[model samples]
Target: MKNFSTKALALVLWSVIFSFGGCAVMDKNIPGWSQYRNPDKVNELQLASSSIGEGNPVLLIHGFGASSYSWRHIIAPLAQKYRVITIDLKGFGESPKPRDDLYSVYEQARLVRNFILENDLQNVHIIGHSYGGGVALVTSVYLAASHPNLQNSLVLMDSIAYPQDLPDFVEVLATPGLGPLIIYAIPNTIQVKSLLKKVYFNDALIPQSAIDHYAGNLDKPNAKYATLTTARQMLPTDLQQFSNNYASLTIPTLIIWSKDDEIVPLEIGERLHADLPNSKMVVLNDVGHAIQEEQPSLLLPYLQQFLDAGTHRTAPNSK
Candidate 1:
């Protein structure tokens, strides 16, 4: 009788684990999860995206754990003169959360390439921030090798291109066993506030609505799995390997960094500028990693200057 009871208890525990895990794995198929789906791979995941205006195309890619919403301040302003495209990379925002995808920089670059090809964009300019910046660099290299004329200009904002120490929380979250459990248990409000404090130079400038928006995404189904998977694949080694390709980038490149950025640091920006033969660096004062959100006004002039220069150079020569 004792042995039978023990076996029954074991069976019950196994059932609970399988039930929760199965729900997370199957969350991709449920309706009302995402409005945008990739037509090429109906079964696989697709990025949630929005494009506006017309002219030269500009693709905006956000940082790790962030979404297209990160570009909210700049998107519309830029769209007035250019076709601005913003996407929530897979597993970040409203995009599909597939359990099987690797969610690495290389994979994200592939997704960006596919998005450009599917949209039939030519000579698309790319603007990426932090993790997105790393993806932009990889994507630029891939395009230079695969489709030489597909890319125009490249802009990296406080991007993570060189090797550096990962944050303590990120290191902890990347651990094999503890990572999953901690991600699953992290409360939405607390997590949002903590991350904002670390990323923003002035935490007081972070609005409550912004906090709610970020926190709400974290509360989505299977968000924990997506977060953990992304964290696991975000190693500096993956980015550093592409550093050698910077010298080969002939397109007009812009490297923007906040002087006080604690995340990626200003030295990384200097290194990136040094490596890129045709690149220029601009350092903003009194801002942290979240430059777009914290100091959009300061960033606008540099973007305009770069885009205008590209436009002038690419303009048709009068007969």
Candidate 2:
């Protein structure tokens, strides 16, 4: 038995995993797809993705508790000038949510890295927000060391890169037993609206459709398991050690932060700017953690300028 308010709050606030568990089927047409095909593993899901436009490829990774739909406002504009790709990370949106414990930043990064390689995308740029920023950071590190020529630059928005205290809601939902119970017991439209309100600086700006879309996904089977598991692994043990790689990521990078971000403080963004040798930091006012959703129009110009400048930069270590 769970308290109604507690359950609703936990389910709504904590939304957002990792693991290369196993692939169910391998597409013959996709080279190297056979390698991930395994019947024993449960969560190595093929991501649900969409792409539009042409020219340089840009991948957008959404944050915790969000799906590709978060990019709804800006994808079209970006696609007009450059190829833009958006994905529902495993267990979020339309992607499969297995009753397994494979959700982590590392696992998500692996899937993202695989997506880049399988598609044979050249000089790709990744834009990640919040948790997705953590995933983008890991992915960039992996590519810089392994496939240096494939990835060109990185754009992180209020990302979780360094170790910090988990948000209060995240802590509540990450608690074993209680977390899963709350997620399944009281997920509904109201809870979804409550959650979005916290992310957006302007709650009135959130529309009815956004609530319906997110709430609908929470109602799906096994969605509880995925979100709970992801909360558990939100902060990996090797975070400090892993984050040390930030200094070596010399590829052009952009760090975007909201001055009013309540979820992740602006200080973290300043810290990230100090660490990344080849990075620029931009702070947007009157927005919360959900920069993309709140005012993407403010974000587009920086994105275009950064991408244009980075388009021809030699890949990391190309020299």
Candidate 3:
């Protein structure tokens, strides 16, 4: 019995050691992880973005934990007709992740507003996916209230506008102490691949290159912490409140959702459509949450039609 007890204790010690030590190993092996662990020199970080093509500006905002590269498949195609601007939100992609910053949707919306104003963009059309959709919605509402003439239209793809059950991984990251441990321990490759599987309808559709790209971003300093912070700040009340005045969004809106999306689900899309009086919802079959990457070909026509419709701005009912 004494021997057995000693062995058990030894095993427990090893387990605890590995739990913490694994993150250290990951930090070394994963490219970019070491560099991102340190705080950036600049206090106020500028969002990393690229503008391509010419015509009416269309800004593409990626979802949670995603960078502007998420729109790689569609940017060139859309740029053929309209100026396509893709941005990495402050905490994701190439954007600087400032420590202790609030990664809330409202904060993100403010950044979007700044981007538009600074660029002197007019009649801008916004397209966002997942969390990006939430940011886009908030941005639209703010524009409507402050500068109605500047806002033209919106496209929400599997957006997170309404309160819903958090995904298991997100729930884990949002937890207090355990969240940090998990975030630190998991390697970027493993985390990115696992998430890609969940976001893609067909596992086979996820390319290794895409996984590598996403993992590279995950390795950046403060990336994991930023993700955890964002998750914690994503309170349902906050999201719902931001979307409260969505009914007053009179701008032409298009909501595209994957019929079988396991992430945001179709119900959320339906709710967004119902809330926006002038919005139309298009359900894509056999696709998942990352519709922009997975099914861009199918999405192009709907986007073209919306953009061609031009500004159909009407005054929304007073809230």
Model-by-model lDDT, in order?
Answer: 0.76, 0.79, 0.78
Q: Judged by TM-score, which candidate is best?
A: 2
Estimate the overall C-alpha local distance difference test score of candidate 1: 0.76
What are the per-residue Cα lDDT tens digits for candidate 2 across 1-319? 4678776565444443101111111112221212222212233568989999998899999988889999999999989888999999888998888876667787788788888877888989899999999989988987887888888889999999887877655665676555555556655676677667878899888989999999888888887677777777777766777788888898888999999988888988999998888888899999888878889889899988888888666433321
Between the candidate structures 1 and 2, which one is better when assessed by TM-score? 2
**Model 1 clashes, total count:** 0
Candidate 1 at residue 29, lDDT?
Answer: 26
Worst 10 residues of 2 by lDDT: 17-26
Answer with 1 or 3, whichever has the higher lDDT: 3
lDDT tens per residue, model 1, 63-140: 988899889999888988999999998888999888864677767877887788778788789999998998898778
| Candidate 2 clash figure, as a count | 7
RMSD of 1: 10.6
How many clashes (backbone N, Cα, C below 3 Å) per candidate?
Answer: 0, 7, 2
**Which lDDT value does model 3 have at 284?**
92
Model 3's alpha-carbon lDDT is: 0.78
CA shift at 13, candidate 3, in angstroms? 17
